[model samples]
Target: MATSVGDTLEDDVVAIPWTSFCDKAFNCLVKHKHDAAGSSLRIYASDFIRVYEEILDQDLLLERCKELNPDLEVTAAYLSEHLSQGITKALKQTCTAATQEACMKIVTCNAGLLVMQLHTMISGVPFLWEFRMPAQTASDAFYRHVTLPMIVMIVGLQKQQEDLFALLNDKDSEISDYKRSGQHLSRKHLETKVFDAGRFRRETLTPKHLKDCLSNVHLNPFGSEAGLMYRKMMEAYKDITTSAREPETRSPKNHSSSNIPVEVVKETRETTTAMDVTRLEEEPKPHKVKKAKKRMRL
Candidate 1:
């Protein structure tokens, strides 16, 4: 519901509808999908927030999922949780934890489907069939807010991260940007925006509007660790771009580069952590905080 001109979406931000997202996902998985006797979509999705808070078995998931919609076919079952908020899709029902390696495969193989899913989460009105995301904590909200835009900015060909948010995500930030003359954008001010955390499908945020909300990579966000997460994504892309352009160079090639396809290098949102960030030592301290706050954001 952001009405201010600053909140308007940039021309580069792509619009995605929920139905289009799911249909594309279904088409991509049609090869692997089959009708299961008792399979359901509602079980695991009954309430994502609660399910994520606890460990669950496949049978219980089937009962709940099937009860919600029997005909709904899942190419891959979301068998396990990744991090606190990451629920992964897989083919098996053994409740195996989705490995980062597998996520890496999805990134390489079905990036379009992945980006579509992100689009659904970012803008589609909160609906049931899509993964029912629950906002429970600052970290959850923070990841939701940043992850959507981050994907479009980096993985997308058409969409780019808005200038406003990009300024905050800049790997190199200066002290004077946050303050000019005697003005200071206080920690409280940053937290308000971080907590405002726009993850809902209907709400939109623009960079010009975010200038009042965002700060350089100096002062830490008080609530969510989105600041830390962005830096890691930027850093990881070095290897991602290198691998995409020439996967063979990074590892032994089973096929020629021409035969192998390059896909979006979007890292699994669940797999990214603060530990993955290696630039903390190089970043100059924010004058506002004696020491930088470092916590897992994604």
Candidate 2:
């Protein structure tokens, strides 16, 4: 950990704890959340480097480079291969050696940075690289890293919502056309209610609802069914993006009429017709009581 004092000098910097930094960032966000017309906060790339070096004290290995140039470049293939191998090795060692408490301490104290534990392989040779990260960030770092990205993400999601709403309306129009042409749906359960975006925003998009969901973060975000669901969603997204495309034609077995028994088909037809008739007959009819005739026993 690094410590610094506030002064109006060239090398003056104040390093706060990671927890305190986060708290201060959160309070700032909450204070300015409703300031919609206010100008957005300005951030620079140097802010990231400054916090990492002056606050976290992690070496980024820039000093080791010739002339301390930050614009050093490498081939993408080389970079990816070395990064993957290094991460695999690091994860194996960490999981095998580190305890749960030790892991938590690393996150809290060191700001989740693995100091000087990475190695890069080049031409069948390995070399140590001290690619460090900031343990303690600046007060506005959260806005740059988290809040700005979230605002952009919300804008994207709102666009997606509008697109979906338009699609639903088009679908409803097609369904209405079918109905106007005297075409009926085979099943009542297939009919969907009209989408109400206003209702959804009122009921689900409330600040209280969001606050309640965020309040449960302390109870282990990845140690519940929600974590499993998140993994499943990621798997689905991966499959859709990377898997091979499906065939255009349907399989013959799916539409084969020979698979159905005659008795079952007749029963289904009769049941559907009976249901339709009952549904059409909305008027209630009076029921007459039948008089019981006295039985003469022989």
RMSD of each: 24.2, 31.2
Best by lDDT: 2
lDDT of 2 by residue, 122-222 (tens): 33233344434443355544443333223333444555678887898898889989999999989999998777777867878777878976774433332
- Write model 1 residue lDDT over 1-298, tens digit each, in one string: 2121112121111111001001212322110111123222211111112111112235654453355435332222332122111222322111223332111112222311221111111011211222332323433322332333345335432223444455654522444444445666566455323212235212545566567657432222312255344444444433343444453544455322221113233222111211232111222221231221431111
Model 1 off-target regions past 4 Å?
Answer: 1-57, 65-133, 138-141, 144-298
Best by TM-score: 2
lDDT of each: 0.27, 0.32
Supply the global lDDT for candidate 1. 0.27
Q: List the residue pairs that clash in candidate 2.
A: none
Model 2: how far residue 233 lies from native, Å: 19
If candidate 1 were superposed on the true structure by all CA atoms, what would the RMSD be?
A: 24.2
Residue 238, model 1, lDDT: 34
> Model 2 residue 191 lDDT?
90
Candidate 2 wrongly placed segments (more than 4 Å): 1-85, 88-131, 135-144, 206-298
TM-score between model 1 and native: 0.19
